[model samples]
Target: MAGTDKQQDMLAEGPAIILVEPQLGENIGMVARAMANFGLGELRLVSPRDGWPNEKARAAASRADHVIDAAVMFDDTAGAIADLNFVYATTARPRDNFKPVRGPVEAAGELRTRFAAGQKTGILFGRERWGLTNEEVALADEIVTFPVNPAFASLNIAQAVLLMSYEWMKTGDQAVRPVESRPEPAAKQHVESLVAYLDRVLDERGYFRTEAKKPKMIENLRTLVTRPGFTVEELAVLRGVLTSLEKFSPRKPRGSGAPDAG
Candidate 1:
């Protein structure tokens, strides 16, 4: 496993690999090792069961200290993914949901496309025992499900992460395309804010109608809003539109009197 090539620069730029509620420090360390093997550096841990700065994880990293050392921990999945522009939830079993699904190869290709466009992306790996919950899966833009044997589909957490990391690396420079300059995609937080604002307005308007259905309504609204991948400027324009609709009044007609000299 000693394949250090100091002469060549390490490939450290790629999608963030997010582990949601990982249970073991050793597993986290193995994940870091896998990430390092494929040049993925950004590691996000959402509520690691064993807590951060675990010595066991460091020991398991096998000299991949950079990935382990730079890892970030978040209180919850939403916070962990708030800064990402796009995300893919890695799950094995079907969740009986409507989210678009892609295999590892196709997912990797899409990752390359988004990365080339200057959009930050990440992939979410669920708990080791069970995969991502439906609510957590809903936060992601799409689903990434591996095409494993039906009889034995479960994959170890590190193995799941490694498959994605490896596919991302395998896609490499060949998958990247020429990208045109454009406004950066709005981060998840921006979308969340917009959704929250809309939800508040809708609640004031009694748009939910029924208390029991409110949660589903909000979830659907979030899914709808997040699917478009709005750019920063687009989001600002949307906010302006919403504000004007809520509060704008007809202004006095521009005065016919000569305007102040420039």
Candidate 2:
């Protein structure tokens, strides 16, 4: 009973953990255990790969019955997060459209602060086989990505959730607070503005005005620019790039730097 109450408190403090179409019962149960590790317990399963209420999952949950007992099953992702005021989709790859992204630590800190501020947040995790679909990603207000080794960046579902849960656990621990190790997303307005500026720079470069296969190339370029979940710092770097181009581009004729006559 005490454990159950503790789990409930954790949920009250932490954001809802949403697993999108998880593939196995064991993984589902493992996720519960991971949540428990960070004092988190509420679990929302959306279109699970293996049907829920399986003994297999129970076995994986082990002593985390409190987590399993409260696990909610949903037929759709939207249904699972319907009551959530904020949603963040976790992915290893990126979307075609520019989406706000933050490091899990930054995201977790933001969530903890927001939860205390009276807003409900949801963290969405995708399937073990495949991550969230483009359609699913569109539903989120934010995105979270880990700084994993590029050679092997594919993180499994439970592992991914664990990292997120761990981050959220450090709400007040100043020693463990976010440092240079992690970066948060740039605001929507900032990203949009930077993108517009980049388009202008690229235009000046004639990157988009070429005649051969220009249409396809521009489409691809736009997608690439829009995909990364850029943080304000990243956006600043790019903006610097734009400033540099604007200063030098549209190059004057040869000997353009000649001193002006008195």
**Looking at model 2, which ten-residue stretch has the lowest summed lDDT?**
253-262
Any residue pairs clashing in model 2, and if so which? none
Residue 237 of model 1 has an lDDT of 96
Q: Model 2 over residues 110-194: C-alpha lDDT tens digits?
A: 7876566565678999888778977577656768889999899989888998899988887756443333443444444554465
Task: Give per-residue CA lDDT, model 1, range 1-262, as digits (tens).
Answer: 2344441235348899999999999999999999989888899999999789999999999999988888999999889999999999999965655778899999999898888777899999999998788778878888899899999998999999999999998888674766675556788888889989987766665566566766667777777777777887898999899888777433232222223222
TM-score for candidate 1: 0.85
Question: Model 1, 259: alpha-carbon shift in Å?
Answer: 50
The 0-to-1 C-alpha lDDT of every candidate, in the order given, reads: 0.83, 0.73
Model 1 poorest ten-residue lDDT run: 253-262
* Candidate 2: C-alpha lDDT: 0.73
* Whole-model alpha-carbon lDDT for candidate 1: 0.83
Off by over 4 Å in 1: 1-12, 94-97, 173-175, 181-183, 247-262
